[model samples]
Every structure is written in structure tokens, then in C-alpha cells.
Target: MSYATALKRAARHNPAWKAASVFKVAVEESGAAVLDASGEFQYDLAEDTYALRDFTQEERFTLHQPYDGDAALTVITANDPNSDHLILWEGQFHKILEVLGADALRGTVRYRVKALPQDEAVPIRHSIIL
Candidate 1:
């Protein structure tokens, strides 16, 4: 079997080896205001929700690191030029501050990512009880 194919299979099944994943990305092109049903004008961000939806495999890099105080908090897509890519999770948004890549050896690439602070926020259920 080919090494590249084997590596791809591993990355797909190994959760420990994967880092930040781009699930949904969005970007607004016009940045125009729209009228709501209540007759109020509101800025539309619906188009800005999938900016990175087209990320290619070569552009995806993630390094899963243990929870350490010194781990990096920012992640960048190495091959993408867009500087405003955002990571959407649990109804919150995390903006990608920079672009970065993973080191590859013999057709395998690995990279790291820092989790967004929003993911650490107390759960709504716990907050409601308190």
C-alpha cells in the first residue's frame, strides 16, 4: 500500500492526531444592511458563515496538543490567503487570526491548533442553575 494513502486513512480515523477542524465558515461580501420583518434595518451576516467551506485537504492542518497553559491560542491556514477566516462552533464564532501550515515528512503533514476561549465558557445549562 502507498504511504500517502495510509497516512490519509490514519488522519481520518485518529482523533488524537487531528487538531482544529473547519466545520463551517462564512463571509459577507456586500456588508449591506437589510430590513427585518419588524421594519428595522439590520446588518446581514448570513453570507459570512461559510468562508472556509471550500478548504482543500492541502490547506487543512491541525495539531492536537494537551491542555497546557503555554499552548498557542491562535491558528492560521497555511495555504489560504483569506485573513478573516472564522471557526464556527456551538453557535459562537472564532476568528482565525493568522495563517499557518503543518510540517510534512514522506507525504504526511501534521500541525497544531489552540482551542477558542468560547469553547471554555461555562455551559448554558450550568449557568442557568447558578
Candidate 2:
């Protein structure tokens, strides 16, 4: 099997990875933002600094991506997350800042995201207001 395929399989079967949902934000006529579920995916979330150092040499070499100090990194599989998307994880909202890296073989996508501000993260019946 290709390295990309193997990597995806490992991430899928790994118990450490968490399941999450992806959402797209839409603005209403009243100028209020609402989150709509777009897709589902699995990810391994970690502090950017720790993840950078913890990643294997092959993984780092494959990514060739850099990140900001305040950003958190999430190694994701299954769904492609856009920069404008928001992720509902651990009962909180995280805004995707940018895609750090994408495997050339389409195995995974690494994203840099930050927890949304309290006011912007207000959830009403599972939908968030941006």
C-alpha cells in the first residue's frame, strides 16, 4: 500500500483520534451568522509546538508546513476543511485559520485553528453565532 493510504488507515484505527463535525457559516438576512453541518471527519488535535516536535520525520518532511505560535494543529482525515469553516469539537467552537498542509497523496489535511471568542461562539440549539 502507498504511504498515504497506510497513514490514513493508521489514523482511522487509532483510538487517540477524535471524531468531529465540519460546518459552514452562512449569514442570514438579519446579518446573523449560523453554522450548518457540512461534513464529518476524524482528527488528532494537539498544541502546535508539541505536535511539531512529536510528528515523525517522514510526517514532517511530507507536510513541509509552518504554523503560528498561538495556533493549534489538527491532523485530519476523511473531510477537507476549508479556511472559513468551523469545527465543533469537545463542546466548543474552533475557527479554521488555514490549512497548514495537505498530503500530496491525499491522505490527510493539517489545519491551524483557534477557539472562537466567547461572544462569537454562542451556541443556540447546536448552532453557533459568528
Candidate 3:
């Protein structure tokens, strides 16, 4: 068998690689939208079509100033090509900034993601009319 196929089989059967934890991967799409009834606009979310897979947090560390904050490195098994892989973990969104994989090791890929900045709290002002 080919090296890529063999690597995949090895990783899949590896006991250390747990398949319990689940996470969502949002694939970026470049296309236009569609118009529906009442002139409402709609687009393919692709939330339902994307595959949910197992990933393990290999490492996490803090980043000093002049750079963004904390970051997490994870390992995921997929034969997908090198591209941006958006991840939704624990209600927080993250984008795969880097990917490391080889053709011989097709099903195993490492991703480094930095958490996207969340919405800031808006202050409400109450003015007094004298």
C-alpha cells in the first residue's frame, strides 16, 4: 500500500488518538447569494454539510505583546488540501492560520488557530431631562 494510506490507517487505530471530542469546521466559500420569496436573501451556510471530526489539543501557550494573545495547536485527521479551516470551539470562533501536512501522511494534519476577537460590550447611556 501507499505511504499515505498506511499512515491514515495507523493514525485511525492509534489508541492515543481519541475520537470522543467533537468540533465544527466551517469551510470558507466564495460565491454569491440567492433571493427567495418576499425578496428575502439567503445563502448556503454549509453548517449541516460540513463534517464533524475528532481533534486533540496537542499544545497551548501564551504569546507576548507585539503579537496576538494565546493560541492553541491541534491535530486533526483529514485528507483535505492545505487551506483555511475555521473552527468553532466552546462557542468561540477560531481560524486555522497555519497547516502542516504531507502527501505521504494524508489523513494527519496539524493546525494552529488563534481565537477571533469577540464582540465588545456596548454601554447604554441614560440622559436626564431637567
Candidate 4:
């Protein structure tokens, strides 16, 4: 039910996701937070991006987009005290949407969309396979 457990489980069941995640490695930031892969919410990340706690190597990659603000990637560079740049896999996550979902940028799916059904209803599919 927790991030560590979920990562472990994914590693156990999904062999493809083993090295793709941080179970085998000694990650500096290991915690819960949703992560999108191939334009899908593949990982169910914890609600708080800055969850008043440590972030694993994976969590630091996502850029948080709240309901009421702009989206930008959060990175703790080598100079920071609490976080280390060594743990940061790369600067590739600077673009939040790209890191979140590669498909999201290529007309596959929209990363953050807020549209309430007014009169007519809109259909939503759980997964998009292209």
C-alpha cells in the first residue's frame, strides 16, 4: 500500500519495470508519488510532491502541476544541503510534461486538463494505446 511496497511489487511482477525503477539501486529519494510512463499514469505517486519528506530518485523527476498554478520541474542540484545532485538521474525532467508522459506532448494525451461537464457528457478512456 506504500510507495516502497508498491515499487517492490512492481519489480516482482513486472520484470520490464524492474531496472526502470529503483528497487535494486540504493536510491536517495524513495517515496510515493504518481509517475507517468508512455502517457499513462503507470505509477501512483503520493499526493504531496514535496511531501515534507525525502524524495526518491524517481519522484524528483516529476514536475508538479496543481489545480491552481503553473507547472515546473523541481530539482535539488548538487549545491543543496538536504538533496544531492548525485541522486538526480538527469536534467531531462526539467520539462515536467515530457518526464510525466512522452505521449502527452505528441497529441497522445493532455497532461493537465480541467473541464467539467456542463450539459453534455464526455467519454473518458482509462488507457490509450496508439
Residues 15-108, candidate 2: write the lDDT tens digits. Answer: 5555455565454569665443643232323211101211333333225655433355555444454686566655556777768777676656
lDDT, candidate 4, 45-111, per-residue tens: 1111110111223333345853443232222111111210111112111112222332312211112
- The count of backbone overlaps in candidate 1 is 14
Model 1: residues with Cα > 4 Å off, grouped in runs? 1-8, 23-81, 88-93, 102-116, 119-130
Q: At residue 73, what lDDT does model 1 achieve?
A: 28
* TM-score leaderboard ranking: 2, 3, 1, 4
Cα TM-score per model: 0.30, 0.47, 0.39, 0.18
Span of 10 residues, lowest total lDDT, candidate 4: 45-54
How many pairs of residues in model 4 come into backbone collision?
A: 7
Residue by residue across 7-42, what tens digits does model 3's lDDT show?
545645775543321233221255433334544333
Tens digits of lDDT, candidate 1, 29-102: 57543444564432212211112121234343347854342122222222333333334333454444444433
Model 1, global lDDT = 0.33
Overall local distance difference test of candidate 4: 0.23
Model 3 Cα RMSD, 1 decimal = 13.2
Clashes of each: 14, 0, 0, 7
The Cα RMSD of model 4 versus the native structure comes to 17.6
